[model samples]
Target chain A: MKHTLSVLVENKPGVLTRVASLFARRGFNIDSLAVGTTEDPTISRMTIVVSADETALEQITKQLYKLINVLKVQDLDPEEMIDRELVLYKVSAAPERRHEIIEIANVFRAKIVDVGRASLTIEATGTGDKLAAMEDLLRAYGIKELARTGKIALARGSRDA
Target chain B: MKMTGAQAMVRLLQKEGVEVVFGYPGGVVLPLFDALYEAEGIRVILTRHEQGATHAADAYARVTGKPGVVIVTSGPGAANTVTGIANAYMDSVPIVVITGQVATHVLGTDAFQETDITGITIPITKHNYLVDDPADIPSIMAEAFHIASTGRPGPVLIDLPVDVSRGEIDFTYPERVNLPGYKPTVKGHAKQVHQAAALIAKARKPLLYVGGGVLSSNGAKELKELAELMQLPVVTTLMGKGAFPEDHHLFVGMPGMHGGKFTNYAITETDLLLGVGVRFDDRVTGKLATFASKAKVVHVDVDPAEIGKNRPVDVPIVGDARAVISAITAELRKMNAEPRTDAWMHVIDDWRARYPFHYHTSETAIMPQYVVERVRELTKGRPTVFTTEVGQNQMWACQYLRITEPRTWVSSGGLGTMGFGLPAAIGAQLGRPDHLVIDIAGDGSIQMNSQELATAAINKLPVKVVILNNGYLGMVRQWQELFYEHRYSSSTLPQDCPDFVKLAEAYGCFGIRATTPAELDDALVAAFAYDGPAIVDVRVEREENVFPMVAPGGSIDEMLGGIPGGPVSEMLDEELFEEVWE
Candidate 1:
């Protein structure tokens, strides 16, 4: 199972290296991670996803907590949280297919961020599964390139996690 | 009001209650060493090698329950300390290692003597720091000590670049560390304590599985109280040997591989296992699936990660061993819980009498067990600290030497480093100068850091090294003998291996040799009476094997080469015992 942990850490130098190196040392790598400042300027929140068994993840989380700069570790359930990933896909398109791609993008409430002679870049933000479905549907049009800002999530409530 | 980073670090260390520093000087750390020359408070011991300094510091921490420190330069100097760092990390010893780095500008350009030490040590250390500025020194130092000594104690490294050392700052030692992520739980939850007590109260054959954590937390008093209160049998892991008094009625010998037969049997039959400050190490829990198969385990450790690491627990409590065990004791007392233990006690007593640690005497060669037995006999009842190098000698020391005090028996428990004993003995002596300090070493492991004998001589430590000379890597040889048909490849050492007495003389310490049991006793008496460091080498039987052995992957009960009735192959229990008894 992949566990999504929202880790809040002090905004100190080398803390990211410290956190990343911990997972690396344990021979486990994060699946998807996104780091940004939280409401407090001095604290940074990292949303990290790692696929591991309960034992390995618990051990890794314990290791992460050993870091001097790390503040709190809250494991979030995907079903209870509102998760989103912003992805930009460059799709190869002919003049006729370009309009079709734009029509599909409109249905998904996405935007054609860039249009080139042979390709159109579409940007969309949605849940991880939704983005995967969008990528699958657009694959028939010959996707040229893709980039994802991993995943960022917040609880489905005003309560602090 | 103003000082360089090096001076600031020295002052900060003093402020943190650090009294001694261990290091070997090199080119990069000259500035730090120079700063130490000006600082009047701290005492530094210059070891022959960086690794020895680390081990000495580790042993210092092990005995004092304070973080030991090491100062070594960059590159190979830092590399040499890796084994020691890993040893400390594995055993959960608190140590802070300071290494000098190349100038910041020259860090990645393959500068002279520059190594990515922090990168190399990432996996081995609990946490590490790369100092960026002079001002960060106070906070970094504070955090390093805090993180090292707190929670489950582990080694922390600090890499100081040359430029950072020379950088100036106004020294203000941080009053308190600001580490939010590292708050270790010191008190067990109230409900959990009650649940554990209820389980203890109901258990008919409950056992207290103690480990080094009890000793580290100074929980021996509470542990003794709990065992007596509940009338539970106790078996300590190798690291936990001194954590419980071996002389107590409830005390069974060490459990698992190379442990006494009765201890393993007792563990095999327990209904409820109360583990305190212990990880179920393979050596202590032969085959995990079969280990305490019938028991409901209640594990309490200061480190949350260690709670269910090896074996899952029925009740996992994360808190200091001293605090948690004390709390549990308090709960049991409040409830006035009494566990029925007559049947369990009878079985344990029967097994102890049937299979005590045994070896037949020839009067021709000194048995290793006898060497340890004599040490115990001679040093009996006095405040003695026994340290050892790993391998067969370590197991013999563990089996034969009886301990009543925590922090009295220190060894390379996890890493099993060969050279640990000598330097650690020095550190133990340094830590507890008024007590008698002895290192029971093997002929092979002693040579690994025989250089540390110089450290003892120079400091007038008056430590004793009792080398149980079997002329082979006895443990490996024993395995080869039983498992690999005795094809001793690189296991045997030439009998002429640097005559220990001459080597000790070379290092300016008194050296003695014994070939028989009587001679061994005489030599021990002389060594103890000597005013300075001494090494007593005893030529023990060459082919002796540690018995009550659990072949790899075998359950603890499937032991070999000990007193009969075990469900395994036997070599010499009946014959050897008859040979001596007749």
Candidate 2:
């Protein structure tokens, strides 16, 4: 099962490597990892999407806690948390296909970030499923290139993640 | 006071209550060494190699329950200590390693003697630091010691650039470290403690499975109290040796691949396994599904990850071993729990007598077991510390050498590194100057770190090296014999193996060689009597194998050898024998 973990760590040198290396060494694959400074400048929050079972997830959390810079780890529940991923797609849109690509982008609430003679770059932010659906439709217009910012999540309501 | 980083490091060591440091000097460490030379109340023992220094520091930590300190130059010097660092990492020994790197300006340029030591040691160390400034020295040093010696104690490394070491800074050592992520749980959960106590009080066939954590927490006294209060049978893992007195009535023996047959059988039959400070390692748990299959496991460990790691734990108590064991004892006392394991003890005693550790006697060649037994006899009732090199010699010592107190038995238990014994004994002797330190070594393993004999001799440590000269890597040879159609391969030593006696003499130490049983006692006595380091090489049977063996992946109850009357396969009925092979 895929688990999105919110890990808070000391904003210090090599903290990222300490965490990434731990996951690598323990054979836990990180599906997606996004790091950013939290409200507190001295602490950073990392939203890590990893695929592991209950036992392995427990192990991952425990191992993460063992790192000196790691402050907290929370296995976010899929139902009780909100997740978003940003993706930009540069599609090979000729003059004739530009209208169709723009129409599809409108339904997904995606923005046309860049336009060139032969391409239209569309940017979208949503849950993983929503982005995948938008990407699927854009592929019909022949995607020239694509970039994705891995998923970031926060707990529902006022509870801290 | 303002001082150079190297001088501040020396002051930090002194402030940390470090009396001795095991290290090897190299190009980049010159500044640090110079500062150390002038440091008062701290003695630096230079080792022949960085690896030897690390192992010696590791053993010193094991014996003294204090973090061992090591300093070495970068690149090759740091690389050489990898094995020793990994060994300590595996066994959870506390040691702080300092590696001198190139100047900060040339750190990543591959300058002379530069290495990414912190990167290399990340997975092996509990934590590591690569200092960017000299001002961080005091706090980093304090944190390094704190992290190394706390919780699940393990090795920590600090990669210090020479320029940083030479940089001047104000030294104000912190009285306490502020590591929010590293606060180890010291007390077990109240509900979990109650649950564990209830289970223990009701268990009819309870067994206490102890490991290195007990000794690491200084919980041997607490462990003994729990076992005696509950009248539980005790089985110590290789790393847990001396956590409970081997002479105690409740003591079964060491349990694992090379452990006693009865201890393994008891593990198989127990109803409740209250594992204290032990991770159910693969060596201890053969075929995880069947290991302690009949038992309800209650595991207590300082590291929460260890609980239910290898096996499913019934009641997990995450706390220090000393705290948890005492809590369980206290809880049991509150309930007026009575000893319910009399029947269990009877069965254990029966199996112990029926399947004793045995070897065939030969007048022509002395048995390795006999040598260990003699050493044990000679060192009886004395403050003795026994360290062993890896392979057959280690297994033999584990089987025969009875350790009555904690910290007396030190070996490379987890990594099973060869060449650990000699330097470890040297470190052990220095740590406990009044104790008799002995290294039970193999011919193959002794030569790996034999250069350390010079260090031992120079220090005049009364350490003894008892080499079981079998002329082969006996463990591998035994494996090839049993599992690979008797092809010797490359396991045998060269025909012109070094004369260990002559090597000892050249190192300015006493040397003795004994080829027969009659000569074993005399050699051991003389080596023990020597005021300086001594090596006693005893030629043992070349083809001998350590028995009571659990074939890799085999169930613990079904052993290959060590049956009292005869081989277990032949003795059992045809149907049962088929199961044994299976």
Candidate 3:
């Protein structure tokens, strides 16, 4: 099972290395990680996605807490959290199929961020499943290049993570 | 007052109440050494190698219940301390290591004697720092010591760049550290303690599975009180050897691999296992699924991460060992809990009597177990600290040496580092000058750090080193004999291994060799009376294996090679016993 963990840590040099090294040492592979400063400039929030069972997840959470720079850890529930990932797709488009790709992009509320003579770059931000679905539809147009921002998450409503 | 970072570090050490430091000086650390020279109230013992210094510092911490301090130069000096730092990390010994580094400008350029020590020690340290500014020295030093000595108590390192150490700053040591993420839980949750107490009161066969945390937290008194109040049988891990009185009636011997058959059986059959300050390590819980399967576990540890880590728990309390045990005792008393393990004790006593730790006594050859037994007999009722190098010598010491008090049994329990004993003995002796300190070492292990004899001899530490010379890495050889068709391979040492007696004499230390059982007693007595560092090389049976063995990954109940003519012999399949015996 994949768990999206929201970890708050001190904004100090080598803090990211410490957190990453811990996950590596414990043999837990991070599926995706996005780090940025929080509202408090002195602290940073890291959204980490990892696949682990209940026992292993508990162990990972507890071990993360042991790091001296880590302040908080929360396993954000999929049902109670909002998750988003931004993806860009550079699709091969012929003169006849360029309109088809644009129409498909419009249906998913994606934007044609860049257009070259032979390709159309579509930018889309949504839940992982939604983005995957949109990418499947765009595959027929021939995806020349694709890049994903990975998943970043926040708890729903007024709750803090 | 404004001072150089090197001087500020010495001031911080004084503020931390540190009196002694073990270190090896080099070019990068010359500035720090100069500051140490002028520093009052702190004495620095220059060790031969950085590794030995780290080990000595580790042992000093274990003996004195204070965080040991170490300072050394960069690069090779810093790299040399990795093994000792890792050993301390595994065993949770508190120590602060300071390494001199190249100037900040040349840190990543691979300047002479430059190394990223802070980067190297990340996983092995509880916390570490690379000081880029001298102004951060006071807070970083305070945090380093605080983190190293509190909670689980592990090693911490601080890499000081040459320029940073030379930089001037006004040094005012912080009175208290303000680490938001490092607040260790010291008191157990009331409800969890109540739940644990309820389970304890209801348990018919409760067992106290103690570990090193008991000693680290100074909870031996509370542990004793809890056991006596509930009449619980206490079985300690190897690291927990001295945490409970070995002579106490309720004290079962060390459990798990090489533990007494009765003790393992008690662990196997117990209804409730109150794991106090113990992480259910793999060595202790052979085949985790079958380990204490019948028991409801109530694990109390200072580190919350340890609870339900290797084993599921019915109740988990996160708190300091001493505080939690005391709380549990008080809660049990309030509930009027009484002794209910009479039948369990009867069964345990029967097994203990039937399957006592045994080895064949010989007339000509000196049995290694016999040597350890004699050491125990001679040191009985005396304040003695016993340290052991890894391999068979360590297991023998664990089996035979009876430690009646905390801080007396110092060995590398977690890491099982080979060359820990001799240096550790030096530190132990230095920490507790009134006690008789001895290192029970193996021929192979002693040779790894034999150079430490120079440090011991020069310091006149009077640490006795007893080499159980079997001409092989005995533990690995035992595995080969049991499971690897006796191929022996590279395990055996050459017939002409360095003469340990002569080696000791070369270091200006007293040396004695006891070849037979008759000469063992005199050799030990003479070595103990030598007044300075001494080494006794005792040649023992080459093939003797530490028995009552649970084959790796096998359930602890399925033991092999217990006492001859004992119940285990009959309990085990005839063919398997014959195979082991043969």
Evaluate all candidate structures by whole-model CA lDDT and list the values in order: 0.88, 0.91, 0.92
lDDT of 1 by residue, B221-322 (tens): 988988888888999998998888889999998987899888887788788999998889988888899999989999999988788888989999989999
Which digits, one per residue and each the tens of the lDDT, describe model 3 over residues B1-582? 889999999999999999989999888888899999978989888888899999999999999999999999999999999999999999999999999999998889989998888989999999999999999999999999999999999999999998899999987768788899999999999999999999999887789999999999999988998998888999999989889999988988988888888888888878899999899998899999889998999999999999998999999999999999999999999999987877677667767788889999999999999999999999887899999999899999998888999999999988999999999998899899999999999999998898999999998899999999999999999999999999898999952379888899999999999999999999999999889999999999988999888889988877889674333324434353234334
Q: Which is superior by lDDT, 1 or 3?
A: 3
* Over 4 Å off, model 1: A27-29, A158-161, B567-582
Model 3: DockQ score = 0.92
Itemize residue pairs with steric clashes in candidate 3: none
Q: Write the per-residue lDDT of candidate 1 for residues A20-120, one digit (tens) a residue.
A: 97888678879999999989999999999999898888888887777768898888877788888899999999988899899889888899999999999
Identify the runs in model 3 with alpha carbons over 4 angstroms from their true place. A158-161, B564-582
* Superior candidate under DockQ, 1 versus 3: 3
Sort by lDDT, best first: 3, 2, 1
How big is the positional error of residue B404 in model 2, measured in Å on the Cα after superposition?
Answer: 0.5
Q: Which candidate is the best by DockQ?
A: 3
Ranking by DockQ: 3, 2, 1
Clashes of each: 0, 0, 0
